[model samples]
Target: MVNECAPKPHVALLASPGMGHITPLYELAVRLVTQHNFQVTFLVITAGSTVAQDSYLTAYPIPDLHIVDLPPPDMSNELLNNMKTVARLCYIVEQSIRPLRSVLNGLKRPKVKALIIDMFCTGVFEACKDLSIPVYSFFTASAALLTFSLYLPTLDCKADGEYVDLPEPVKVPGCNPIQTQDLMYLVPKSMINEYQQWFMHVSRLPMVTGIFVNSWEDLESVSLKAVKHEPFFANIPTPRVYPIGPLTKQAEPVLTKYEKETIAWLDKQPKDSVLFVALGSGGTLTSEQLTELAWGLELSQQRFVLVVRKPSDCAISGFFSAGSDVDDPIAYLPDGFVERSKGVGLVVSGWAPQVGVLSHPSTGAFLSHCGWNSTVESVKYGVPIIAWPLFAEQGINAALLSNEVGVAMRMPMVGEGGEAVVVRRKKIESVVKAVMEGEEGKKLRRRAKELQASGRETLSRGGSSYETLARVAESWNIET
Candidate 1:
């Protein structure tokens, strides 16, 4: 009898440990199976659960995709609460590699082609290599950062010691200038080793079969150009880079009460009249900052819907904190702010349907934390941004959105600190007014509309991004 258990044309997708990391890879897996014809095995490393994990996959019921979840590793009672978050995250994710390898034990057929991994979980590259499965590093961050990363091996030679030692705002060959402030934002004093380790992992890309970037050409032309055409100093060529994205979440109709209420409020508002405020799902603020934000939104007099993750003393929540169960976020707002702004502003405590909100006709602008996912979502929906970057690569993303993309205006953090940059009521009011109704806002809206059109065209069949993604599957040399 013929071997009926033979593997199909399979592409394994690896997701790391956070909502930010997992969601994108999950969406990519779904897309590969739905949009492209590839058979996908989505290998998620689940170490317990996260706040966003509760209802993360409420959409996308694709039948063709097979999901294998590797259990979280058991650890000693020496909990990682005090460990530098960067290292802790990496350490936790690395535990899944052994199980992932075991899961790969049966995927040895000739057609079992490639593994597309979240860059953070690149530890599995070794496993893929050992299994002779070609790896493609899928990055969810912006193309600018990808370009910056591609130049890391070169930057190491130029820097006297650490990247921080290269002075403020180091300029890469073909990309934008990167400030030491932003560098410090990504790799603070405590996480230097993790920073170096990240670069070390990134340096492994050339050895991989390809790199998948989540940005389209029009969105990040220069950055994409630099990565593809502009070679690094030593003529060390990079692998095939695919700009197959704006791979943002497609709109799925939401049914929750909060979503319904928010949508109702938005529908009642005037067209292009509301400022949709959300600092990504993981972003939290101090009470004082929250108060200031309330005052700013109220004082600005712009109609708005702010998704409030309960204000926290923590500057920002861990890359993903399973989120707290806050029944009411209104109490944290300035006195009567909610009451006064009634019918004018909506405060969505806990999670709101973001893609739906941005696509609404009432959405005038988004006060975003400039997380790459959030940034892409805003851009993809044609909403201009009020860029308030909190942590990670958000600062640079904010800068890129404002300076390079011409689709947003940067909001300076309060008191020159990363924690609360004390956005006062006055500044908040002015900034809100400028972005919502002022001339700059109109110009930004136009540019954003242009970008939205470009994204749609590129993502459409036969478009550049679509063609690029097609090639990625074809490169595996296997039939769907």
Candidate 2:
């Protein structure tokens, strides 16, 4: 129990840009406040912030949680536009150091005891170097990815050149072997050295006080075990690893007219009948891929709700343009595709209420980009996946879901040397048909439900995540 006589220990959570990063940190902050009796200040690094980010935060409010947006640095759009996503995220964090330190120094009321940072914002550690407070890393992805990352430094020394060119799959003990193309955080060839150096710097465990991964023991026991117990890591100076999640936001009641209408349509569908296709907030496909997906859905003759984005060659083309003005994605669909599949499908042009849609009874399967947030949400709602991973750690996540967890069937990318990166319409149709009608779909559904139940169990009172967070909370109190 919290010591009622003592003041609540204060903590600060730093979130990087993107809904994938912000959502989990926000949810984790809420849990710390409500369940662990800690006061939390949520610090958002406001570089390239999105409208969806603003709307999501405003939707959920808690009295104990104080939200702060760090001043955006005066970086030109042209400069930011030229850099890739990872480079941009890193640059933003680097620029925020001064303002971040000022925010830390200014918080005097029940002075902050610990600061937890998003994985990308590790550069801000420079700001905290002189402070007495401890800094923790909140890894918002799976433990499997975490294992792979921590093992990268070793892989770097042994491998000759680019990881993408490795002839065989990369192996981490006790985890699924990762294919070369499926590697997380692989940058362009020109930036490989910089990227490797950056990851090597972060992999050294003594840098942070601990790690808070958005995963549970039941979801990733083997990878979690490898992080803690593997002989390979015994020599490394590892930080405390806390698997304290499935920390995803629950669907609030629908307020927007579009959301209400979407939910209403879902309500009318048969149970486990409609396929929900969304490629997260940032994922987009090439026009060719988009056309193939449309025709595939039409051919399957199955019910679907597809959230379409303006097609681009870059998979993450929608990253900075999430809620920005542009042409409707529906206009880009194959000719007569929407009209022909009108009753059987609903094509939302921009964003969809993912949590609400996944929770709906008719959402039997999800065709997702397999972003970690989307992955955890689908698992929480017991929705099997058609794992169509685009970039970042998504490919790793897809491997985990389809290979290790058995909760998803991966969509294969067919091409020579990654030149042709599209899955043809026939393959898309077959996967959709299998997921909706084949025996494999039944198996995936069963596994999804099993993981869903395990997720709930791990978050309940006296459960693994609950106990871990409680212990961490008590430690912060003691440190203060």
lDDT of each: 0.77, 0.84
lDDT of model 2, residue 120: 74
Q: Write the per-residue lDDT of candidate 2 for residues 113-172, one digit (tens) a residue.
A: 889887777766767777677899888888987887788778878887877778899998
Give one digit per residue, the lDDT tens place, for model 1 in 58-176: 45557767777776688643666665566677777777677777688765444467888877777876677777777888888888887777777777777756554454677877788
What is the Å distance of residue 227 in model 1 from its true position?
0.7
TM-score of each prediction: 0.92, 0.95
Top of the candidates by lDDT = 2
Error of 2 at 76 (Å): 2.1
State the weakest 10-residue window (summed lDDT) of model 2.
184-193
Q: Predict model 1's lDDT versus the native.
A: 0.77
- Please identify model 2 stretches exceeding 4 Å from their true place: 1-5, 192-201, 416-420
List clash counts for every candidate, in order.
6, 0
